[model samples]
Target: MDINRMQDKIIAEFENLATAVNKFSYFRHLKKISNGSQPMDPEDKNDRNLVTGCSRKVWVTAYKEDGRIFFKADSEHSITRGLVNLLLKVYSGHTVSTITNTDLYFLHEIKLFNYLSASWMRDFLSVIQRIKSLAIVQHLDAAPRS
Candidate 1:
């Protein structure tokens, strides 16, 4: 699905839940997606990709495939892992322009910012920034050297 649709879907899912308990319940279900993502290898979990400021260790790696970005992430915490999975689902398999240009309002619409503490939310925002930075670097690398 396109990024906007995916964002809408996430918002809808969270909107379906009326209470904090229900939201947490739905978040637990996101673990299934997290479990299905590829695990980060020990070598891939180095400090370069390790997301700092999070309560738990979260590592992310990105590469370009067929002009689209792909991401791999691993986190010690299930909720963080699921958040990574959610981001990968939206940004992966999309071109750099799409990745960098897309507006990520779903994060707020889903109330993730409200649900998570300031530090945890910062970690999540950092993950998004890292993803965009990787996309920018990849885009520059793919450009023809003049």
Candidate 2:
């Protein structure tokens, strides 16, 4: 029921996961988003916006679009892309406040933290925080006066 449990279940599903399979999965997510879904935007059109925490070449972009926070991401590896999809499914479609305030401790409950080393964990957390901050700032900017 919690993010931790849910993450464990998800991990169990991927316990035998090969990195190559993850690569293919990212392509699947991209195709799915490209078909009709709105993927999160990368922060820049250039190489500057790319996320550095990932094992592969990854880019994550976030924008407060409509009433929802839309995230578009891409990775040079399939599994990493799948990871992005997993993050998107959990983090997207919520309002900025919702995303910012939610007990993301659920990720810990899901055991999503084990695979990474400390540095990677720090970067990953930084990425999540950045996305939340961008969404919150955008929302405040767009809010109408009472």
Error of 2 at 29 (Å): 13
Name the runs in model 2 displaced over 4 angstroms: 1-48, 52-57
What tens-digit string does per-residue lDDT give for candidate 1 at 45-136? Answer: 88888876666798888888788888888898888899888898789888999999998988878767666778778888888888888888
Q: How do the residues 1-146 of candidate 2 rate in per-residue lDDT, one tens digit apiece?
A: 44345445545555445554554453454345334434444445346657655445667676676887767766655545555566665676678767787765545543456555576466566567656766787688788979
lDDT of each: 0.82, 0.59
- TM-score against native, each model: 0.85, 0.59
At residue 19, what lDDT does model 2 achieve? 51
